[model samples]
Target chain A: MTGTITEAAGAADASAPRVREMSMQQAVNAALRTVLREDPRTLVFGEDVGALGGVFRVTDGLQEEFGAERVFDTPLAESAIIGMAVGLAMNGWRPIPELQFDGFAYPAVDQIVNQLARMNYRSRGAVPMPVTLRLPSFGGIQAPEHHGESLEALFAHVPGLKVCAPCDPQDAYRLLLQSVRCDDPVVYMEPKARYWDRRPVELAHDPGDMPVGRSRVLRRGRHATLVAWGAMVHRCLQAAEYAAEDGVELEVVDLRWLKPIDAEGLAASAARTRRAVVVHEAPLTAGLGAEVSALVTERAFGALAAPVERVAGFDVPYPAGPLEPQYLPTIDRILSAVQRTLEYKRP
Target chain B: MTDTTERTFALPDLGEGLVEATVLEWLAAPGDRIGRNAPLVELETTKSAVEIPSPYAGTVVRLHAEEGEVVQVGSALVTFAVEGPAGEADDGAAGQAGIVGRVPQDGEAPRRRVRLRPPEE
Candidate 1:
């Protein structure tokens, strides 16, 4: 299948590609398997990725065919894995290391920000970290502490990292391949909870069609513009579905890449809807949502329907217990923000 | 010992398309009893730490690749000795050469395995 949304919809070629219903994790596995088979240089590494096939079985059976050299296990150390990846990138290899869970990525923040991210800039573009760091992030899985934290904001704050989250299986497959092929380092956030949720995806499109830092308008609306990424993209869609019953039309933009933001798309969306609401898994303060909101307000001040509202995680460390529901963004929360934004009158 | 029990395991492309990877450490050795999906070795690729699972349920008879040596894709990494069903012997080399010939070309753009391409690009 081409995975090209445009081609899939219009092509009169009745011969459709084979389709299978797999979970998000499975889709990711398929993507990895395909890439690894296609590119002999693409390697997968993470804790328990071999015999255990990763704690989530995202890498099951890889070792058998790929052998110990290509598909093996790493020590239970996050920092070491990332640091090693940096070294590998320096030596002309593409590394895709899994952070395991969202919370575990913190241990490697130093290598990520100070070393991997800055290597290219400090070297005056002589060297670049083409490594792709995959993080299974966000809550609702009911996992323990540090497992479902949304830390894209932290990486987004850095200058070098290209942060993105794929909402579905097709995006999971395509975005991952794209990230691996990209020249700059990319932080690919996988929403653990929505691994199995199914939606139709395009088969093929021109490579490099979806550029980094471009926000995709997932759905069109006239009342408000909802800017979101990763898991929240799904939530925003759900919120749009529900709001439709109440005659509320919303424009939803999936901010696929974070660092080099799609300011133009966002500003244009805000111009059409005249209302903006930023949503994310991170807290409002110092979050990417805040940055996006500020950017829209500063750029689209003349076409404002109301102040840009943000729906995001609370300002606290992600809780271990049931508080996870409250820690991350929700559909209701997004809807409420949309309603609030729509209600705000122009001064 | 029957020759039918021996199986040749080809190196799989770990999630990354690394040309060659170093065996950072070996978890299993020759003559070790191994099961399908068992942890055979810990490999350090250019990306991260990873473990290689046993592709065959058998004993490790021959170690083809050494630690710290860069091994290429489709290369033979290990030979497994298996117990055939009901006193029967198996050929380890049979049905494997075809696999080597079918290795997908690297760096092809993403093509959907199922379904047509979407309408709006």
Candidate 2:
């Protein structure tokens, strides 16, 4: 089924290719439009998604172009919305159910963990749950309670769900397209803070299919490997620049696929640098950073010059508007962690 | 004086201070006999799509708004003719009165009041 869609996409790309500067949110909308046009089985629905065009407007104008049946709104019941997606995927429809916000996803976790993630395994590959649960995550937008959270670790821990958090517009567009085509259930986490960050992206030519579970080395360095994903990738890059002043080089690796986690690429980078720092917005305890640190220890243990350091949010619940900046991983914090890793010596 | 034989069911404020909603589809049309608490129309608000039930049990005489039309809260949605005596019309109105003009207090859960059920025999 995906093969035919890919062919159709390839044929569509033949006419003319063009590049456009768009925000991450716009890129997401464009990717959704492209997928909907190429695939008939795909349908998008969530709270206020139709006329309201989604709270962040990431789904703006989709309902108009696709019509109500294709891109419509659902009742404000998160559990029912996701449960329906599970059933829809089981019955041959590719369902993209948006959770609207990160904290609001907790109600749907039961369906996500028990039904969507385990469907293929339970059915022994007889039923393919091509369901993409899109969630706008992370803080910094002064949103009300239950609106700001970075719970990627929660979904990443689940065995069967493929978690992808794209940092920039280009990856946002490409990753979302790939997620829709994947046969397994995917959790597409969009960093709410980076939604409106505009960047020049080539939209004319299809970048072709990006293989899942691959990491992109944004910057190459020798002193230490700095690993980050989603919004924190940009922060890591900034920290790398600051570290360069002190003659400490840091290679920034963007773990695009949070679950499969580009382990080989990470290991290779860690092996070269022999030092590592993992960064994320989630709380320090049980965050995705710990998993990355563990992977480095397991795969590149012999090459390590220092214990893997993690710069992440505190264990406290995401604080109110004023405290968000202090709560998230800042460039200073990341640089300090990198310095700590570089200065460490075995006794 | 208000008419005792008929009642107008206006679009309710579905909480969150929402003023208007696009009428997605009308489940019951004019001349259709709908029972109390039966779904009359599906409305698309800024939060979610919900079915607005008929507050009064009677024949739907007029559907004021077409599908896809945005109707403001407190505006008439559907008119219904009373099945019983004129004096009982107020009772039907009273029973359905809570549907409109009620605002949720702070921290209150949004209104999800449309509970569709088969007409009582």
The share of true interface contacts that also appear in candidate 1 amounts to 0.00
Candidate 1 lDDT over A293-316, as tens digits, reads: 889999898998689999888888
Q: Which ten residues in a row have the lowest lDDT in candidate 1 chain A?
A: A3-12
Error of 2 at B18 (Å): 16
Native-referenced TM-scores of chain A, all candidate models: 0.91, 0.95
lDDT of each: 0.74, 0.80
- lDDT (tens digit, per residue) of candidate 2 on B22-100: 9999999888898877888889987679887778878889889999899987788888986766776756453243332
Which residue runs of candidate 2 sit more than 4 Å off their true CA positions? A1-17, A204-209, B1-121
Evaluate model 2: give its lDDT.
Answer: 0.80
- Give each model a TM-score: 0.69, 0.72
